[model samples]
Target: MTGERSVPKPLVLQDEDARGSRLKNTDLSDSFLRNLKMRDVEIRDVDLSSSEVEGANMSDVRFHNVRMENARFDNVNLTNVSITNANLAGMTIDGVLVTDLLARIDPDDDI
Candidate 1:
């Protein structure tokens, strides 16, 4: 007989409080988290590719060494966001290329 196992059901966590918990080396891909209060949380070494985040408040959040290739942000606030020494190649703002804008500001500087 072929060694084929049936797919397991998804784990559902409702009305659960996981505050102050540390989840290390865990795979939580394709998980649905709604109405979660995750303020003052630090996420490191996590893979969030193709994750859909809607109506979330991420004010004062810091991201370092994050891979956001082909990622799109809509209707988000960036009032006091600071990006330094970041590769903004092919990155756009309001449908305008960031590199082009930088070139206009500083023509001699290689972006």
Candidate 2:
């Protein structure tokens, strides 16, 4: 069965303070959000494909059913970050694949 996807609208916000704001039923595809800060924000059922976040602080943020395909991250500080039931296919850290290293350490990781 084929499912239809609803494309999100184009959004651009520069130097805007959207703290404690609620955004519902919106498409943020191809949006450029620079210097945006969000505290205690709730984002559900959102698509952030090809989005770039630089020089920002993110804490206490929760994501459900999110897809981060081919996403790149660099020079970011991460503390208390927990990832479960993830697809680490071709995922790398410090120019090394995680699955490959794990396979070597364990030789049979069936988890």
Candidate 3:
């Protein structure tokens, strides 16, 4: 798909103080999110392609079936982040605390 794909509108990200917020089927494609602090946010079946997420503090976030291609995570602190069954091609992650981010998929492998 060219450009940003269609996704669910206006997902409420839980703050750092608010942990374990249940979320599902959200679309965050081609969006710009900066300086967001959240905890235990579950994002399932979301299209997060071509989005710009910089300087965000996302701890204990779970993403299932999310497409994060061409997304930017520059200077973002992502501790305890779990991403499953997601396409993370061309995504840039720079300057962050990614102690809990485990990439199950390899970007070098052909799909």
Candidate 4:
């Protein structure tokens, strides 16, 4: 068997410590993560589409150049969060359109 490649097995880490590790070009799709202490972690160029996150404490997090189209967030705190230069088209807050709210705030300004 020449030029044959072997399939890699799934890597499992239970009760293991992997702090201060850098992961690049890793495929973690369909992976299950529970009870993880990922505070002060910096993640960049990651694909987390169609992922379900529950019971997460993500306060004081910074997001830049992130694409979150058609993403739904429920019961998430946005205190003191600032968003600028974002595409808010077709976005809503509490079943009310954001563009409508902005229109109410400043009727003369075009949205």
Model 3 lDDT per residue over 1-111, tens place: 789888656655444444454545544455555555444444544554444455454444445444444444444555656555545444334543243233554678785
- What value of lDDT does candidate 1 attain over all alpha carbons? 0.88
Query: Model 2: runs farther than 4 Å from truth?
Result: 1-20, 27-35, 107-111
lDDT of 4 at 47: 93
**lDDT of prediction 2:** 0.71
Least well predicted 10-residue stretch by lDDT in candidate 3: 91-100
Identify the superior model by TM-score, candidate 2 or candidate 4: 4
Residue pairs in clash, model 3: 7-27, 8-27
Candidate 4 residue runs with Cα over 4 Å from true position: 107-111
Candidate topping lDDT: 4
Candidate 1: C-alpha RMSD after superposition = 3.8
TM, every model:
0.82, 0.64, 0.33, 0.87
Candidate 4, residue 100: CA error in Å? 0.9
Worst 10 residues of 1 by lDDT: 102-111
Candidate 3 overall Cα lDDT vs. reference? Answer: 0.49
Indicate which candidate wins on TM-score. 4
Runs in model 1 deviating more than 4 A are 1-9, 106-111
Question: Residue by residue across 30-68, what tens digits does model 2's lDDT show?
Answer: 556555555666666666666667777676667677788
lDDT of 1 by residue, 15-61 (tens): 88888989898778878888999999989888888899999998888
TM-score of 4: 0.87
Error of 4 at 13 (Å): 0.7
